[model samples]
Target chain A: MSTPIETDVVIIGAGPVGLFAVFELGLYDLKCHLIDILDRPGGQCAELYPEKPIYDIPAWPEISGQALVDRLMEQIAPFSPEFHFNRMVAGFRKLDNGRFEVETDEGELFHAHAVVIAAGGGSFQPKRPPVPGIDAYEGTSVFYSVRRVEEFRDRDLLIVGGGDSALDWTLNLQPVAKSVTLVHRRPEFRAAPDSVNKMFAMRDEGKVRFEVGQVTGLKGENGQLSAAMVKGPDGEIDIACDRMLPFFGLTMKLGPIADWGLNLHENLVSVDTEKFETSIPGVFAIGDINWYPGKLKLILSGFHEAALMTQAVKRIAHPDQKLVFQYTTSSTSLQKKLGVK
Target chain B: MTKISIVAFDSTRFDVDAENGSTVMENAIRNSVPGIEAECGGACACATCHVYVDDAWSEKVGSPEPMEEDMLDFAFDVRPTSRLSCQIKVRDELDGLVVHVPERQA
Candidate 1:
């Protein structure tokens, strides 16, 4: 294992709020190292609704979730916050000197004076389907997410589930795959009306096949699928397919955060509104992962909390440095620090 | 360039040249105007950039899209003239536009 990453702060979650925390903490001259379970930043925004338009942001009337994340990435560019992606924080403990040490599931360790829990709704993991032997085909013929569209090219793809992901992949993979079959236990879909309608249209046009059933069995050897046993209303039917896409949605768990010895209410970390610090000093919580009176679980609300949290974080990180309230607009020192000159 | 006036909750007003293709949020951040957090960097994902369009310019600023309307529901105080600054684009026709930033965003 590599040496533990030493920094002033270790911010868990690279969502909008966590990314903003980097800017706030950086303003106080604190270096930050961020870790997220997702392979990329933006959390739910990039993972769930990258293209969905949002209208409530204070300045812009409307912006896509992905664009918001991109701009934030740019805004925080000057901070150079380090990110450890595709890793889950597995261990957290207070060091003897009052600093904190955090370890990831990947065995990477991080040491910091302050720890900020910006994880929004915890980590998102795909709900595994109930089909036995499905795990045997995972990473080869069974996938929860379509990382690359070309991977399904020329293959027989059978997509399961009634949500957006199933319908979306059915529609997207229809043209590329040699054959596309969509299977859902219910006729009613929870997907967007537009996408559901388009999927039906494609099915009616013979571009895709629709089956009402649940994948009950997987037929494959060494992770290569040859067929799937589907349980329809009539009976079990076998569908020839090389790939199975199941979109059973995601489950969010507090995970190791709950075991860190912090006070928790309703599976959320409780913190004070002033410093947003949890029961443990040197450890703070913000964003949806934190709960406080009158707390609105909004991205900007987390941003404001991050701003206030950093003041306390600065005191912890560098007790010798005097804290000052300065605006990025007119503070020449801040401007110089940000390399704005 | 067009000129836009952004008034903060304290009634502190800032008049800056608005870039033709930039959104009002961009102009506020560029001028370092307070009260407009633009936390998501103008992404409509958060309500930090909430602003009240001057009554006279409400029609000129136009109405919020359905998606924007859904988001405005989360703003601290929603008003007929409350608009997300990020959604309003700057153009020659929007010159002299004035908006008031809320004391605190949602």
Candidate 2:
């Protein structure tokens, strides 16, 4: 029953498209508040391929993923759009007053005249390792991420994966946990060389056990893990542990957006090419999440959708204001919003 | 065009004529081969397009680069011959290559 934050528009994502929407909406004096599942503004650009170069972005022949997101943030700075990081929009419903109410999994609520779903490929969730029957022990005996270090104090911990998340936690929790076993598919690690060397140093002192293998099976009762069956280079061996943490990286899931009762075409929100508005009025979908006849999931396409969506949003937010479109290059009013006039 | 075959987990074979410079992952998607998600669209980012090289074609297909190897850590049930299909280009040497899709993608 908390008070909802009121705004002109509530953007469901903070990626490149969502960031650009702020610029388009800001030109017409529409305020925006964006919510993202990731801790930062950029979605896939920041998470999946930060350093990976993207060749198709207009004007710039070559730009890295993180660099594109950074530029988008800079472009949208004039809008002063509020960002809610590490939050997922769980509940979405139309209010009786014609405004839309967006709720997060964390219970924060927002009321806006319009909603922009710029969610690209949905939210990035931690990938669950393909070990059989791992779901039963998820909350109790298994954890994909560490929220508190003290939770593993004096417990037998089995850490799996060759990535930095696995190595860093193995080193960090070794002293805190009663016993630590680091298991991987290979001896070669994707983690930093310095951490690998320190891990080897720790293994030499008999403080931690590093095994080259994968957890094939789990033995536990009622979500209480007893031991894990490791298929290693030698053979199937049991590693006794009460807790297990497997870091397999992340995957994109459509998440709660599917439950909003919007017209969907193969898991993507069905929208018109005009304003990119969904079946529900005032609720617009753009970027990769939206589906049209000839829609491309490129950043440029999303940018175009944002510009059109903002014009429609402005009419809804300010019903009495006169509608007049002007270019940022020629219009003093638009330039004033950009703070260049 | 180079010939390549993608064997699904159910053993369904999809033989395709792939263009040179295109990736094995693209050919799988173009032919609608099941079990090859290629979620990242051949960026060598996501490991959903993972495939195991047929024993005979393993040596000719070659091993994954360091970047592709790092991405393979995100894949499920990664075997010794496991490779992200996007990393495998359709070169003439790889003609008549065969790769088996795994049970599930990450």
Candidate 3:
């Protein structure tokens, strides 16, 4: 018999919820293997706008998405798992031995006893539209969102996407970029009113020029996006641009887990309230992969789900040990020992 | 109060009484709907209050502000029906609307 690769769990996606699961898994003294496509945790938060404000997560009241991610990484840093960065999960296959083997886009392989498909939204795919020769500018000029805003402090940017993401980025880079030109497929804007009003204001100010069309083609000459071709209402035209920030929004393709036959709710994975089980046995789902009663789907909500699911996984692994949650009061315990309030 | 049904991924359905004034996110958070966080306190800055406007009721829920849509990019499971729960006000049209939460919030 082959020796089994034993990890208490393998979590996919390093987003806020996935990292929170890693934190929760540590509480149970379980060794886990965490994987993410992005180079770091925080999922879309880090991938998109790190400086953006976030209010819903429990605690901290109000914090930027990046700051929240920092604190979350801090909470999990103490019990860090084996991290696999820049690795995209291709899919998973259940072995005959009741374990799982996961494959990634990098051709790496991992085996774990339990798998928590924490892959959130699956948007890190950076759903840039097909540009004829955009790949030629990979290292030099053509780009997705501005990874480092400082580098493009004064450079001209050609942005795509009429939705909220596009307009918001335009407004954000208004003060930063030398100039901002926005392109949209439809005449209508899909974002909220505040952003629309701001864009209109920017237009009146001549800070931004809105093109009512879509990006048809792009060519990177001299390691830069020198010519941006678009299909606008007026006609097809090429505009001089230094870089292209396509904010068309990432397309999330739910991975192989969909084949697991789990109960679903409106195309979302469904989970039993008590056990957090999928339609099949041995293969369990948690966090965003599976949903249960009163599922809030927030970071705090996922933490609670992970906490309870960890207990369930532990029971499945070790049926004999009675899992009793021990609420901790570090300050209280220290006070009793040192005779201090 | 208009009656609304919010069936979360957990399959635990909530039948809430939405008034004519408060936003959908506020009503859910106030009534303790299992999923939406609505963390920004109704400000469009926080996308935590994300919810999928049921396909059938999409028009009734209207659309979100540009900020809300931008914030949604950070949400876990964003779809065409996605809307910041905070932006969707509970009105007569929103009556009997249903929402689904994403895998996680930002």
All candidates' chain B TM-scores are 0.96, 0.97, 0.90
> What are the per-residue Cα lDDT tens digits for candidate 3 across A32-137?
7878878887887787767666777766778877887898888777666778898877767887877788777776777776777677665336654555566777
* TM-score of every candidate relative to the true structure: 0.65, 0.64, 0.67
RMSD of each: 18.9, 9.1, 12.2
Top candidate by lDDT: 2
What's the lDDT for residue A287 in model 2?
A: 96
Candidate 2: pairs in clash = none
Alpha-carbon runs more than 4 Å astray in model 1: A1-6, A37-71, A85-88, A104-109, A121-123, A292-304, A318-330, B1-106
Q: Choose 1 or 3, whichever is better by TM-score.
A: 3
The number of clashing residue pairs in each candidate reads 12, 0, 10
Kindly indicate the candidate among 2 and 3 with the higher lDDT. Answer: 2
Classified by CAPRI criteria, candidate 2 counts as acceptable
Which wins on lDDT, candidate 1 or candidate 3? 1
Docking class of 1: incorrect
lDDT score of residue A293 within candidate 1: 84
- What TM-score would candidate 3 get against the native? 0.67
